[model samples]
Target: MDPHRLLIFREVARTESIAAAARRLGWTQPAVSQHLRRLERQAGLPLVVRHSRGIRLTEAGATLLRHADAIATRLHAAEDDMAALADLAAGTVRLAAFPSACATLVPTAMTNLARHRPGLEIRMTQCEPPAATTLVTSGEADLAVLFSHDSRLPDHGPDLQLIPLTDDPVRLVVPTGHPAATAAAPLTCLASTPWIAGCPSCATHLAHTCEAAGFSPDVQHSTDDYVVVQNLVARGLGVALLPQLALDAYHHPDVRALPLATTERALYLLCHREALQIPAVAETVRALQQAATAHRPQTPPAT
Candidate 1:
């Protein structure tokens, strides 16, 4: 199949109208329609059904659309590869990261990169780990800063590589006068206390840890924002488990952070294996490591 024709068909399939696809591609509608016709002839099947509303893909079109999307992703990666050969000062590096990492590590890395390579273009997207990983793997971003509560991360597939960035110790965050607002929280101290949780993955890890400590947390509220989590805790809504970076990013005066022995979020940089060949991406990675190292927290001893 012709790759160019596949791309045109993919665009039309996405927009559901040849004219809309043409507008986006800067081509005439008849030209796009002709390409689709030729593509269908090559496939030997009716690829689309047209009606007053728009277009609908036939079964064969749906199947081929998946391949077309993959081809498009590969083409984008090829573009990045060619761009990597250019001067480092003129290259671009894209990064995706979760909110906490964005708040702490990313800014530092970005600043350092800008200082060292003034002409380099750095782009960033704020997303959770799952979305961040997908962005890097799909060639949408060159590198991703993501976290896993699990020390052992799952296999993210063969196309990707991971580098451990730093360890962010988890802490017990409680209202000022809460019973466990001390240096070391045995966790059992808050067994019957109402709990506030963060993202789903963090909540799952919190639940498992609580169970291991001989009780299940009575989670009463949830929020993904670290600032919100600390603010809620300060208002005495419920206590929470938070990573050190959350406190480092923004801490509420009315809440206290106590040590949670053995619990920590493992931070990592994820990227396509080929991404590191680009000078801009490599420099970004090095800067990220330095930032992570500088901000690394000292895990409080278990009391």
Candidate 2:
């Protein structure tokens, strides 16, 4: 099948209108229609039906849409792999990471990559944890750095692969002057205190932790900005539940982070299963694992 025709058909099916697909693809409407017709002829089936306002996929079209998406994803990965090989001394590795992970883990990972694989280019974007998996699965990023609480894991699509990087404990952050800051007690003791939260996924993790402690936390503020969240806590607005990573990277004089009695979160490296086979990706993964191993905390000898 013609790749161009399959691409056009995929776009038309996604938009449910030839005009919209043409606009998206930067092609004239007639051109899009012709591509769709050729695709249908190659498949020997009626792929689409005209609707009063747009178009609807026939049964055969729906089946082919799934295959088209997979094919497009693989083709893009192949191109990226080829480009990386062509310029082994200099090629980009696109990455998506959560805000806290970006600040704490990614800096070290990138530094390691630079020292060891200086030829490998690194590009990173801060994304909400929920969206990180999608970015990798859809081929928008070559790799994703993501985190999951002990109670909940982020869902990457089945075709995506995960590699464990670090298992860090979650901590509670409060204003230094707050009574809870000095107390050596379980997180449940602060349930009634107003809490600042990260994005929805982080909030869910906090909620789960609180539930295990036998009460739902009173969330007073929520934001995707890690710096803003720390600033809010510093101003005594409320406390927050966060990973040790945030404490390590964004510590403030007014904010104190306490280890939670129970709960640890896992940070992971995610990529499409198909992309993992690429040589550049494999080398990058090795660099990341080495970075993680070197940075992992060592247990002190018991007295």
TM-score of each: 0.70, 0.66
Residue 181 lDDT in candidate 2? 56
For candidate 2, lDDT tens digit of each residue in 97-189?
Answer: 887777867788788778766778778999876687788877889998888776455687788888888887777777776777556664756
**What is the overall TM-score of model 1 with all chains considered together?**
0.70
Best by TM-score: 1
For candidate 1, the clash count comes to: 0
Best by lDDT: 1
Q: How do the residues 1-303 of candidate 1 rate in per-residue lDDT, one tens digit apiece? A: 999999999999999999899999999999999999999999999999999987999999999999999999999988885665455665778889988889989999889878977877779999988888888878898899988886768347688999889898988888887767553545878888889888878999899889988999999988899888888888888888888888889888888888876889899999888888877788889999999999986547222
lDDT of each: 0.86, 0.79
Worst 10-residue lDDT window, candidate 2:
294-303
